[model samples]
Target: MNFDAFITCAVTGSGQSHKKSDKVPVTPKQIAEACIEAAKEGAAIAHIHVRDPETGAPARDVALYKEVVDRVRSSDTDVILNLTAGMGGDLILGNVESPLPLGNGTDMAGATERVAHVEELLPEICTLDCGTMNFAEADYVMTNTPGMLRAMAARIRDCGVKPEVEVFDTGHLWLCKELVDEGLILNDPVLVQLCMGIPYGAPNDPNSLMAMVNNIPKDWVFSMFTIGRMQLPYVAQAVLTGGNVRVGLEDNIWLEKGVKASNGDLVARANTILSAMNVNILTPAEVRAKLNLKKRG
Candidate 1:
């Protein structure tokens, strides 16, 4: 618990948070600027997700990803870039009348299309959702079957990029282990992210958190976070559980009650807490070294 800690600020998620809080970066330029600000505020890593410049919705276009990567790389900030490879497969169910094909606004694609940006941009880290689950209140579903995960893992391995396995529940942990066992993913200190309190997935509770943590392989390097109001409390919980912390507009939009948060404000608040607890907040370079991640080419 007294070990050095690192915080990854998920600057802008590929979600509708932009409308909820203006602080959520929309375009590539805005995202890059937020990353720089987060780095200055003490975030070791910037977890990035590109949005359609016009609509502020999630976009899997390679050009958008390239621009964001270019902007962040060109900036003076020294934050580790962690791109998202977890898009392009959103299946929203429709009524029986139009159930034959997916309803409008449903974006589904092959595994190759999902990782196109990862292969092209070659970031040091990328996220791979280990499993799928029911989404929000709508009839939407996040579908990532075992076969698809294997294919994506093989491609990520070939690219020599570290895959940050994101586990939304216990089943996902089992899937991550399967990937590791199949040799698609390398062994020892597997990178796992315990994503708590994300609609229809695991609830944000001590029992749920402990269950997921207990299931993690002892040799794996792990981090955990919750959404919305639970963000700050989950930080303390994750640290107490001996895992890293993740925070940003992606998971939450407010810094506190009635106060919306900027990406920089969230990171700054987490850093202040870390310092107060006497934990040495590691830098981006330190995180890369610890995780055995190579710099992007």
Candidate 2:
């Protein structure tokens, strides 16, 4: 396992969990504040997902992203900003009775439409979900085909931003390799984020985690995270596998069973674990240099 590690706190994700916990930030101001708090708690990076203020639903408005970026940039914190380009692909399938068209709640778009926010508010790191899958109990499908992923990657390259290829399964990793092979992704130290223990993706077992780690290219920079109870376990697992770690309310809402956690609590917990293991948690500048990410302009 590598000694140098960095913790990334995903402040608030674009999911249907706003009502589940009041800690999840819904407005742009609230989200930026959450990032700041996480940074204060020793997180080197902050992964962000914007939502509508009133309804607390996921939104793709460029202005919303602009506000978020502006607030974080103007803040005292120096956390590396990572915006989500994983929106705009929510496809809810209808029941068997009416499966031809999309369901009534489907909110999806094409590749270019998915990344409209990233184009405008070009953060240092933006996520490109490598593949699609069923998201929890939702009737929707998170769609990201090879063609769409390639297009999104090209756009991210054009924006002079690094794309953290988010791999939810082995097949998604294969797609990431395909992107590299096709030259859509610039050949450098690739950044891959292994999303474990999702509803339909890879499980959070030791074998599954190691299988994914073993398959990753040696030169690739990777991070790992799991949801709910497995969040902290994956932190140690990720560190043990010579990779960085990601933790926040986006994946796990609770610090303990039935105890909802804030972003700061999650970062602090990860920091404690890393420190106890004699691993130095990286700072924001260290992470930026390690990932070769340009500071947000």
Candidate 3:
């Protein structure tokens, strides 16, 4: 088990969770403020995703991303910024029989367009989903093909930002190696986030987490997280598995059943949990040095 771990708060995701809780930040100001709050509450990194302020849906608007980044960068509090480049790859099929025409929520795009924010803003880190999956068991499929991934990884490298490889299943981990082998990933200790318990991805169990962790290259730095209630438990599970932890309203909004939580609340809880277990919760500066990330302009 890793005695020292860093906490990442995924502030808001590309999901329609605002309807369930008003605490989920929608506007850029709110999102930025929440990120700052999480950082102040002991979160080393804030994984960000923007949403349409009016509609409260996922968005790929560069302007929105810029507003959030600017807000955070100009703030007194310091936190590692990680923008999601996993958008604009949605392929919502009409049905199993008639999948060609596509349906609503399908905002697929080319690789360059997908990473527009990273190119323009140059966040310290951005997420590169290792592989695609039938997201949430819905008709929509998150499409990240190998060729597209190669192109995207190359672009992220060019921008002088680190890509946090997101692995949903064991196969995704293999693909991550392939990217590294092909010279796409260049970090000394490659950053990887094990996205467990999402739909048909890797299950949120100790054995499953260990299976994925055991296979990872010894030098790679990995963090593990799960959705809903499993989110908190994974905090301990991840540290015990010799990995880091992730939490926030994005993965799980409930501090408890029928209780809503903000990004700060979740981060504070994870810090409390880690403190109780005698684990050292790392700071942003510590995480930056450990991950070898350069703060961008």
Candidate 4:
């Protein structure tokens, strides 16, 4: 079991979570404040995704990212920043009868265009989804082809940022190893996030989680998380299985059945869980040292 683990607070995800929980941050100021609050509550890293302040829709505006990053950096709170590079690859196909025209939600872009924010802001870490898969929606698919992943990984490396390889299934883990073998992932100990319980990804069952874990390279670092009601429980499961933990409004909104949760609440709860298990929660600086991460502006 992992005696020491770090919690990554996914402050705001690029989803319609704001509609479900008023506590989910939408505007740049609110998002940054959420990150700081999570840090104060013992989260070592804040995983961020910006949105349209007016509409509460997911957005890829570089200006918005700059505002959020600048606000967090200027704050007294110290937390590692991890931006989402998983935004621009969304794909919603046209109706099944006639699939010639792409759907309105299709937002595919070139590799460089996808990581524009990573190039400019240069966060300490960014996410690289390892493979394409049919996401939750009926017609939607998360498209991250091998070619696109390689290109994006190369660019993120050039920016001196660590790419947190996000693996949704066993195949994605294989692709992650291939990237490591090809020398695209340059970090001394490659970092990975096992995203379990997504609709079409790896199931959250212990066996499935173990399948993903067993395939990981011995030297790599990984964190595990699941969505919805299982989020809190997985905190213990993750540590017991020799992995770190992740929790925040991004993955799960409700703290309990009839209650809503804030980012700080989630981080604090994870901290309590970890502390109870005699697992030490690593600080942001400690996580940097463990992952061999380079902190930049």
**For each candidate, C-alpha RMSD in Å?**
1.2, 1.2, 0.9, 0.8
Give RMSD (Å) of candidate 2 vs. truth. Answer: 1.2
Per-residue lDDT of candidate 3, residues 5-80 (tens digit): 9999999998878988999999999999999999999999999999999999999999999999999999999999
- Structural RMSD, model 4: 0.8
Which one wins by lDDT: 1 or 4? 4
Candidate 3 ranges with C-alpha deviation above 4 Å: none
Residue-wise lDDT of candidate 1 within 87-129, one digit each (tens)?
Answer: 9768887854666566777888898988988889899889999
For model 4, the local distance difference test gives 0.93
- The positional error of residue 140 in candidate 3, measured at the CA in angstroms, is 1.4
Q: Write the per-residue lDDT of candidate 4 for residues 61-93, one digit (tens) a residue.
A: 999999999999988888999999999999888
Candidates in order have lDDT scores of 0.88, 0.88, 0.92, 0.93
In model 1, residue pairs whose N, Cα or C atoms come closer than 3 Å (at least 3 residues apart or on different chains), thus clashing, are: none
Top-scoring candidate (lDDT): 4
TM-score for each of the candidates: 0.97, 0.97, 0.98, 0.99
- lDDT, model 2: 0.88
TM-score of 2: 0.97
TM-score, predicted candidate 4 vs. hidden true structure: 0.99
